[model samples]
Target: MLHYPAATPSDPVDASDDAPEAGLLPRYLARIGYKGPVAPTLDVLAALQAAHIAAIPFEAIDALTGAAIDIGADAVDAKLIGGRRGGYCFEQNGLFLRVLQAIGFEAEGLLGRVRWMLPDDAPPTPRTHMVVRVMLAGRPWLADVGFGAAVPPQPLAMDSEEAQPTRHESYRIVRHGDVWQVAALIEAEWRTLYRLDSVPPPAIDYELGNWYTSAHPDSHFRHQLIAARTTAEARYGLRDNRLTTRLVDGRSDRRYLTADEIERVLSEIFLLPVRPHWRPAIERAATAEIVG
Candidate 1:
């Protein structure tokens, strides 16, 4: 179930005032480097999505570092805006949804089950992923900017089966019964990304999902460090001290980094500010598999 946030007609705050203050819109725009029209048009939607993807590094370092996390836009601002940092799905997409509404897009929040690692025939994964559905020109498009490295750079038509091309890859959403399966073309093969039902998720549902994803013993984010960011040319990622880059032409390169390079990747590539106390733990985490 897709859920529309509370409203008081046209007021950006009313749309999704999850942020502590209504004035966060301008900061959000500037942070993403968007200075174009805010009209509810495909151009604006595409531009915003692409700009956000380029500007934000989808990382779980804060969670791994024991920093506080909340889905509130205020927390997003505190963590990402000036910190030169990033967050996982809830923090990223929650902030993105508020930005869309503040700008005039008719946007709603939804949740998805990540099938990225599960076989098609395996039991459905939990609804742990967050997505935004925006209605523009009477058509609904899926605008997801928080799914990490393999994410598309623009909004995609939800009802169309045709592949939508982006700077890094081509993506398509296929429908089966009441479920929608999102897929991306990678290395000449189509890979399922995630799945969503017609039902929209409420805020409490997100809180529960966030608990499992952030604190559960088996959650991937609770372990070693992982971060990634994309540009028009290549995808850069940090999995511990291993740096991997995949170019637009399907060319790929991988190498392990020295301790100094690891710090640089955390600071420069991921655009994150490293705290002194967290550095030693982070360095050791680079090669160790953390377990509860």
Candidate 2:
């Protein structure tokens, strides 16, 4: 069994100042393009999950720019409201947890190891991802909108074989021994992506993991630029300067873009506002790969 950090309010919300007036939820919904009234139940969780996957993308530009990825509520709010952009697992899941709390859901942060689709013989890398566990209607569900391609919109019931629908792919959670694994159906076969035990993780646990993901030399985010978004039938990924889109039918298309085109696509498709300094950084990184 994996050890998880205890839950403690990392950044306490002050009822006097930081509390969102009742209207705050509505504003957030509008910002995320949610077209329905705020439901009082776990329906809000589903709505927020969909809206987040649709609106706030899964991006990793901060690692390229050497910005410290912070995982606190105030920091997440600043990035969402002030920066006017999306972030990777730490920022996206952190903000999602805060929104769940604001709307009266019992949620807690959880950590997981990423098993990349590289190879089976590769060793598992631990403590590099963050997700959330929510207690709704006397049951626990997994909610993760930060993952780029395979994000599901609704909370998936733990230990369930039921196929859950999202804005993207069909997902299911299954238990193998003491470990719980979330799998996606590709070509009608289940693929075990990552596993997490029923361990409650605190905000500080994610903060440390975020640091390594953003700053560690061997981390994938350090050497490459990756931003991905998911639609119901397809998933698009920009890895380094190569753009690839894979369909549910197992068809994939890939193309390499110039540095200028990469920046343009980031602004146009991904909705990221790039600074002038980032342009040269991307060019240098992409050119280095070509020259080497």
Candidate 3:
């Protein structure tokens, strides 16, 4: 069974309030060097999605560094503006939601569970993801800019099987019985990305799920470090201390790095803010795994 909470509208802002029309969004986008137009239309959504994918990356470094993942808007703003780095789902989606609102799109936050890329019989682990619901031209669509490798910028129709084109890939949603599934086209084949029911989810509904994803024993991020970005032909990721780049041409390259080298690569290549606490945490987790 699936559960969702009601939408809680963010505090209202007066039109006369001169609190920077661009708000923290344009600056955050600028920090990541995203130079794009900001009109709220289908074409603009596509452009923004492309700019977002090319600039701000999906990452989990902060959670590994001992920083709390607060999904609140102000906290997210502080982290992006104050820390000058990227964040995982909570942070990225929180910030992206505000940007969508500022850009004149009607948007709301939604939550989802992640069913790993295995058999359909495997139970889904609920609250593993966060997404946004955007209303455009009287249609409700899904907008996610923080799904790490699954980020899709253009708002996708909530209940359609039409192929929506984005800069990164073409996406579609299908319904099987009561369950809805998201898929991405790769090599001319449809690949299941994840699935969710038509349940409305609220912000607080995700707190527990977020906590578990960051702290649970079996959580992938708890024991490994992963950061990835999509390029024209391949997806590059740092997995558990190894850097693996998968090319669209079906070539894969893996490299092992020392602790110091990992730190350097994370900061320099992945654009992560390497903190002192990260090394010990990664070491402890790796050591525990080795002994187990």
Candidate 4:
């Protein structure tokens, strides 16, 4: 089995606050595959969000490999950007938030509950999810690229309940009291992704939440091989040994993955590379899993 290092949250993770150097913006722009304007305008926000989803991905490799999760923006830059890998919500949104701030966007961090996969009768899950809220033209827009589902390819308006179209699907938001629920149109049925309140979260709150969500022994990510990324055509998912793809026309594809195939898919589908030294750990993780 994989030997997981002890998770300690005493270490402080700090992101770079200095303005980007001459070449830094180009490098980051290359990473996200976005050549569009870096302005804080609405058009720029939507395009950048779409480019992020297309370039980066959502993966649970750290959780699966028992690696400690670091939610800092610089950590995101080094790991996700330099490493050419994808990350979960905290990392993804953290990196995006810094970019928006650098480019002069009034982007704020918000917490949301994970209610998408739970049973309809189940109570609200913890506020483990993080999303970026950008303000443009006196309106708030949500930019979330970390969700595994095939949600709207662009940011959804905070005040609009109408279904907004994207390159892939249509999505809308509904406000209830202090909470705002986001849903996507799938097969003509509106499915809830998650819900959030307008309250802004401090940096420390995010740190604590990231620690619990990623490092907690009983956390769902630690035990399961969960990964997902969406494109204009389909949404790819991985759970244990199953690789599932759901397309836009409602047709779906499912397949089982062998250990070798799993590694390959990690590179090809999820844009993650398993270092030669890390193979044993991944191998052990697969063997220890009941599904494999």
Top candidate by TM-score: 1
Off by over 4 Å in 1: 1-21, 288-292
TM-score of each predicted structure versus truth: 0.88, 0.83, 0.79, 0.85
| Model 3 lDDT per residue over 130-207, tens place | 777777888877777777665664567876788876544688888778566788876687777667656657656777
Model 4: residues with Cα > 4 Å off, grouped in runs: 1-24, 277-292
Ranking 1 against 4 by TM-score, winner: 1
For candidate 4, give the lDDT.
0.75
Off by over 4 Å in 2: 1-27, 118-121, 162-167, 187-189, 232-234, 246-252, 288-292
Candidate 2 lDDT tens digits, 43-66: 556656766676776888878878
Model 4 Cα displacement at 152 (Å)?
A: 3.3
> What residue pairs clash in candidate 2, if any at all?
none
Please, what are the lDDT tens digits per residue for candidate 1 over residues 144-259? 98888777777888989989887678999998988888999987888999987777777899998888788877777877678888876888877777788999888999888766
Per-candidate alpha-carbon RMSD to the true structure: 6.0, 7.1, 7.2, 9.1
Span of ten consecutive residues with least summed lDDT in model 1: 1-10
What lDDT score belongs to each candidate, Candidate 1 first?
Answer: 0.78, 0.71, 0.66, 0.75
Position 161, candidate 3: lDDT: 86
Ranking by lDDT: 1, 4, 2, 3
Best by lDDT: 1
